[model samples]
Target: MIDAEEKIVQMADLEIDPAQIAAYIALLAEEIEASVDKEPGVLMLHAVSVKGSPAKIRILEVYAGRAAYEAHLKTPHFLKYKLATANMVKSLDLVALDPIAMCSK
Candidate 1:
């Protein structure tokens, strides 16, 4: 059974520098993989680019709870990703979500 009320969901909207999109994605992949593989609280970290706008990125993040999401921010891989992609990111927006219902396989 899952405690839906305890889950923390967020969406990240990002714009990467056109020339640095490849490099930004590489770092993001490393961070997402490490986060999901090593962190028990990380439920999901899915990223995608707009169909026609390769530089526009969106990430859907789901954590077990607030603490889990906070812990994720302190992870080494995340820190490294932030540092490495700082210059590659042109803009970033993070939005919190309150899921009315949740379902997954």
Candidate 2:
């Protein structure tokens, strides 16, 4: 478990147009992969589509700290993603979270 006070977790709730789901997912997956590969401070980034609802999307993003997240915003891949998907995203909600506890095997 990480120290909750130091960890930065963000929940991204996205609503996409049905016609843009495939393209949005492709872009999202690519960004996630690139973030994890290129940024050591990016702890986790997992995206999922809601079952039976093709336009609804959810993502759980974890970073080492606030500074890490700040840096993530300035990365080339992230900038590219933000610019590329500007029109494809119908709605977006980003929620900052305090990690109570987390585990992975």
Candidate 3:
């Protein structure tokens, strides 16, 4: 078993169809809320759009570990978001991250 998932991070870059921005955002927010509320392993799912680029979106996701990440993929909310936004998404890119140190005041 792969333990220690609290350090897992993922960066997703998305390009959405301008015509579907509102609808896609609604679905994405709904799913994010559901995942964060219902899934214990989901640490965070933050979505943002580039300045002056409404069609460009980016998401920063943090999970407890590998297991948690995989579990997220199979969740109902994630599936719903995936299916609903398939046509709206023009491109998607996922990047994995390794944590070294974090400092906060």
- lDDT leaderboard ranking: 1, 2, 3
- Evaluated with lDDT, which candidate comes out highest? 1
TM-score of each: 0.95, 0.93, 0.88
| Candidate 3: pairs in clash | 5-64, 5-65, 6-64
Q: Best TM-score goes to which candidate?
A: 1
Q: Rank the candidates by TM-score, best first.
A: 1, 2, 3
Q: Taking the tens digit of each residue's C-alpha lDDT, what string does model 3 give over 1-105? A: 334335588889999999999999999999999999998888788899999998899998888887888999999889989999999999999998775653345
Please give the RMSD to the true structure for each candidate, in Å: 1.1, 1.4, 2.8
Q: Model 1 off-target regions past 4 Å?
A: none
Weakest 10 consecutive residues, lDDT, candidate 3?
A: 1-10
Q: Relative to the true structure, how large is the alpha-carbon lDDT of every model? A: 0.93, 0.90, 0.88
Ranked by TM-score, the better of candidates 2 and 3 is 2
Q: Which 10-residue span in candidate 2 carries the lowest summed lDDT?
A: 1-10
Candidate 2 lands at a TM-score of 0.93
